[model samples]
Target: MPDTPTPLIWLAGATGLVGRALLTELGHEQPVLALLRRPDPSLPAQQQQQQQTALVDYAQPASFAALPAPSQVFIALGSTIAQAGSQAAFRAVDFDAVLTVARAARQAGARRCAVVSALGADPRSSVFYNRVKGEAEAALVALGFERLVIARPSLLDGERASLGQPARRGEQWALRLMRPIAGLIPAAWRPIRPERVARAMRLALAQEWAAVQVLESAELQTVGD
Candidate 1:
């Protein structure tokens, strides 16, 4: 057990858009242990000093045995169909990989998790992306974390240029059209900044509720604000 200081937070997807923002929100207040599939030498010295990384193969459960216990876990792992190159590839990252990390962490004594899910996620949905996200959510919930925060954000806007990551053109177009008429749209359907979603996830981290808590896009709008 940690003394005086807060327990470590195990963060996955620490290189992604929302993950980057969350790293800032947690700052130095909460110690973090980042789980990565591989080492990143390009990381700045500050990040290197602040957080320790544990490399674990996502496809193999045995690799997770190396992970230390964490009080909080954030599962931000995701991939687009375009980025993944195929439906199978996309599902492998968004669904299978996410659950693998969550299960391993659960077994390692992580009692809480904040998962980044899509706005329209539903296990019974016809849309493949939403369905996969929903399934991941359901699976994680079944693991019975003390507190599980489900953050459902719409189009995530961020400076992806820094990471050499591809922009989702479809989401960009939707955001452009919606920005002008944003007030006309429902709060849950509006575009959200990656930072906002990060803030929401951080808020979830602070809660000690013993039930599943869902932060919809509309609620996320206010939580981050």
Candidate 2:
């Protein structure tokens, strides 16, 4: 049992866009244990002096085993298909890497796991992105987390410098077009801010839900809005 009542959060993808937002939100609130592929020497000394930082290599189980015991874990690992450059590479990052961390967290006594997946995630989908997201979700569930919350948000709105990425241009245009008729779009398809998704994850972490909580894109929008 932890000395304090607040649950320790195990965060993966600590360097990504969503992960950075989560790090900002959770700043000095609760204990956080982050897993990074290549541990940042300065980051460990700066933020997590009393906290834990484990360097993880997804290809090896020994690296996964280094994670500390945590009650809650959050995963925001993802890659663009272009960045992945191949279907197998995409699966390795989006699916295998996620499961690797999840299984390790479960083995280390993590009770809850939260994931940030896309809007149309379905294993049966012909789309590669959706299929990978859906498969990752399924694999996480199989890890037997007592409380699992999957957050599916559309066009995550975050303040980040776009590095010549064209993926979200249409979503941004659609949101701008729909802004005048905001009442029309369905909940699951609404654009959401990344901070709101982080808030929802924090809320889900603090509370216990009997059923697996799946926050559709619309629900995320509501929370984010």
Candidate 3:
């Protein structure tokens, strides 16, 4: 009998809060191929050197064609409408880019995938953000992966400034207002750390599943923590 080859994992969005956390969590366990739009100077040199990487423009389909085969993939790409400056621009990243990566990964031989989505996601949601998230989830489900894990986390808690990202005033205000009575809030609605979401994503991918698995914020709190 021959020894089994180690699985190759592909990760998109290597610079976001959850993405960065995923890099640290996944790198130690597998040979990860971190896909980035540009080089991140904020990433520690030692950490950057530990993994394989490919600079890719998600908008360019040709960029993903040369990717090495992957057994699993993780997508943490996201953006707010405010940051994107329009609903269409927001959808470009949250929906189109995300689906593009999943399609490319599937074509590259990936069978397992995990993605970061938001709470209150519903395909029919009137709210643009949640609707887009829901639509992205639906699109991934259609990709026919053996195991698909969608993590729906509440407001993510992380140091955006450290990552060279501008602060979200709404998020900051919500954190401040909730901090004093966090324990009283429902787990499903409570803000969660990006690290916890990343950990949960890793754990979910490690398990065997028939098809799709959805992790809500409450479940993430229990398992991810």
> What's each prediction's TM-score?
0.90, 0.82, 0.96
From the highest lDDT down, the ranking of the candidates is: 3, 1, 2
Displacement of residue 222 (Cα, Å) in model 3 is: 0.9
Q: Looking at model 2, which ten-residue stretch has the lowest summed lDDT?
A: 159-168
Instruction: Return the number of clashes found in candidate 2.
Output: 2
Candidate 1 vs candidate 3: the lDDT winner is: 3
Candidate number with greatest TM-score: 3
Clashing pairs in 1: none
| For every candidate, C-alpha RMSD to the true structure in Å | 2.2, 3.6, 1.5
lDDT of 1: 0.83
Candidate 1, which segments miss by more than 4 Å at Cα? Answer: 1-6, 41-44, 180-184
Candidate 2 lands at a TM-score of 0.82
The better-scoring model by lDDT among 2 and 3 is 3
lDDT of 3 by residue, 134-209 (tens): 9999999999999999999998878888899888899989999987888999999998989999999999888986
Q: Which stretches in model 2 have alpha-carbon errors above 4 Å? A: 1-7, 40-52, 162-186
